[model samples]
Target: MADRAGSGTPISFRGIEKRFGGVSALSPVTLDIEPGEFLTLLGPSGSGKTTLLNIVAGLVEPSAGQLWFGEQEVTDLPARERGVGMVFQNYALMPHLSVFENIAFPLRVRKISRADIAVRVKEVLQLVGMLSLADRRPRQLSGGQQQRVSIARCLVYKPSIVLMDEPLGALDKKLRMQLQLEIKRLHEQLGFTALYVTHDQDEAMSMSDRICLMDGGRTVQISEPTELYFRPQSSFAAGFLGEANLFEATLVQQNGHAFLEGAGGLRLGPAPEGARPGSRRTALLRPENVRVLATDESAENEAIGQVSEVAFFGGDTRLTVTLPSGMSLVIRGSTGHGLVKSGRGETLRIGWCDSAVTALPEQSA
Candidate 1:
């Protein structure tokens, strides 16, 4: 299991904050990334994702807080001395150097002998499946192949921690997905500690052991992929990690269960335990969890809506259903399994069980 704690000391951030000019890029943040675990920093642009990663990599100095790598405090350490590997969005391979030389550069800089460098570079090239391209220059390789060389270079140094900043952002969708699986496999094989930064929700969810979700310069949530998807702690986290239908509601009663009332007489059942009653809240429901029921099927929560729009993706069909209350919800169903034809003004019943809904304390929308 990804959550299985290791015996080694974990990375800890204590009240980490960074400021630029008058703007605070990252507010007070604290977290512990387990040793030998794959952790991803996920957020929108300017949300301080890269800033936080840079801080971990010693590329940027934090205005406040301390950073620790295992039991050592590295808040003041320089980049070169941090023993961290970094793969950037741009494959930073030297144009004049072949793949073998590129992977050997770090060892050479550290004063390793030519014989040792060759052995290390060969091992990493084979690890990344780029052994055959060892003599090729950056210009001689495809985007994916170049990335492999870059990754090989990073790993050749055997850094304790690897930090990747949008390393796949420049690749096309198909190639990106391919590399995503490759990286996941590599992580499982090596068990090196990694802190990945990306804006793509699917990419993060697919590869990371846990996702650290950030927004507006603050850490919003830290959870395993499935937990983050199914039980987000905040409305921002719920909406950002994946698609969700969020609605403002008021908690009406509390016993073993609670009820929520939304606009246009939309009444919903109790949220999961831990939600207090008599408070305004936000409900997040995933599209896949919202079912399109047959006319006679009884549902825990039901809404009458008309199909306002439909989109056919290869594997799934996305439907935009406008409820009678004038709220529109996006629902996803298997392409071959959903209703064959749905158009504007077509009536449908949409519902979800009590398990699908989550309530969060009301925050600024």
Candidate 2:
């Protein structure tokens, strides 16, 4: 079973570009996807994530450059010849077919033996945890179950690479989260190369080995989830990936210490490395790094703000704090924190360590 599950394949995209007449949908992108790796194309609408995915799927041909599947240059290969299985957002299951039949369709299309088809179908059905519903039609199953069947169908043939385009987008929040983990588990078990596309940043962060963050029809940054979230190279990457406090601040050296000074005399902890004093820089501070200071406690960067909003989310709470400068910063913390219990109109001093503040390049902003 382990040997049969090793269908992972490496992929390469070199100078791939797409244009619709005079409009460019995807810029020249050069990326390599490792075997058995889960790489997600993440961005908002019209960001060319879909275009790049389609290019790899062979559904959209690149206007220039080449694509390689392992050592094979598949730039001109047809979609059917690419050894790629696609799972789509709409759960493209046959309405009239039962789960078993739907999953067996791909095998049957390739003219596999009846015995082989049954074995493959059974394996994928068990893998997706829907063996009990093999006889159920698409309409009889829940949206998540239908999607599982769709995924099972894609896996039944053991395609070298699997492409999922927002496959969990249609489900509710709880179900979406559930499927995300399920997909990750399956990827770990089956060890299939996966190229996923989604506009959901949380989904990308939670599932991918690395996230390819895209914008303006180009790849902005490709890095691990933690790096992309915490140490983004661009303001767009920082602001787009998560809740961030972005400020235009100036580096100041005083009394042998370096700090950042923002508008309205706002002061923060030490500036990032290589920052020259008297130079203005864009700094990003994440919400989770900010904590409410106690009476006797202090932080390198502290600010007093009025709680403008509060939202409770079971184990944690989020607060929107408006500083004296009219700038707002969001803070998230465990419910046990004193600041998490604070309500609107309450004032509190929130602080973060110097390392929490990251300076961005001027051109990146």
Candidate 3:
């Protein structure tokens, strides 16, 4: 692949805010997207993920604060003048144009010579593994094929930054996974700064170098996927990233180790930092990190619960255990882990390592 002239550029949002009538679509947010990094904006609907992406694309201007592309200020720049590439969910390819023409559109619009446009378009098609489909129109290709063309078009211009708004939203699961690998490869190969937006936690976790988790138009947490999943700082962050077994408890400290104590002698700990000793807290236990213990075994973090339900999902089994306090616990383990030994209505002891519990701040009322 040919190297782009200005391949990678950093983007910065300095205290950006957006509002419409009496509603605040986005609160003040300050973030920096590093050069050549794939940063994902992840959150649920109405969480302002799309709004932040649009602000970077120059589609929606911030009501307050400045936007910067590298050292240059682009707060007032128009969408076309910002020199950014955009890939959308619907694969916004021209239905009447063939693959080659669709990829060549941007170069032609810039009035590049006929021969140069042809060369650039062919190169991008080959980069995306779609050169063989050059003659096919959008209507003639499958959903995946059209998306490949859409990506090829975005790459043909070789813009320094690419804004993707759920580009894989329309594809089936198999195709989505396949394209995810391709996109990761292309980003690594070409080194374009990318800001991708999606509501799918799995997609964000798999593709992002760092995830910027958002909620209700505010930034919840921004960190690598592992940290976000294992060390969430808030209740919303704990629940949004993946399946977490959350328990309400009061924070307490004995000697040096912190603990969370709930009703029925349920205690879990080595709580995370910044937790006040007497404050209320929520203990986050990841299903995969939880262990189903034997009757005679014991640990610092243990609970007695009756089996409620069991689900087998190919390589793993999901067990639902109801505690004496009527709390439902979700535990994920390998199918061969002997979880079924204690059938439904049977009592079992479940435990986790003290280090596995992530104590987070309780939700505010």
What is the TM-score of each predicted model, taking all chains together? 0.93, 0.96, 0.93
Alpha-carbon deviation at 240 in model 1, angstroms = 0.6
Worst 10 residues of 1 by lDDT: 1-10
lDDT of 1 by residue, 202-309 (tens): 999999889999989999889999988887888778888888898888777645456887778687657545655667778887888877887678789999899989
Best by lDDT: 2
Worst 10 residues of 2 by lDDT: 1-10
Q: Report the C-alpha lDDT of model 2 over 1-365, residue by residue, as the tens digit.
A: 11233569999999999999999998899999888889999999999999999999999999999999999999999998887999999998999999999999988889999999989899988998999999999999999999999999998898879999999999999999999999999998888899999999999999999999999899999999998998899999998998888999989998997888887888866777787889888889888999998899988778999999999988889999999999999999888775556989999988898888888877764
- Model 2's alpha-carbon lDDT is 0.90
On a 0 to 100 scale, what is the lDDT of residue 349 in model 2? 87
Instruction: Return the TM-score for candidate 1, rounded to 2 decimals.
Output: 0.93
Q: After superposition, how far is residue 65 of candidate 3 from its true place, in Å?
A: 1.0
Model 3 segments beyond 4 Å from truth?
A: 1-6, 253-258, 272-277, 295-297, 340-342, 362-365
Better of 1 and 3 by lDDT: 3
lDDT score for candidate 1 against the true structure: 0.86
What residue runs in model 2 are displaced by over 4 Å at the alpha carbon?
1-7
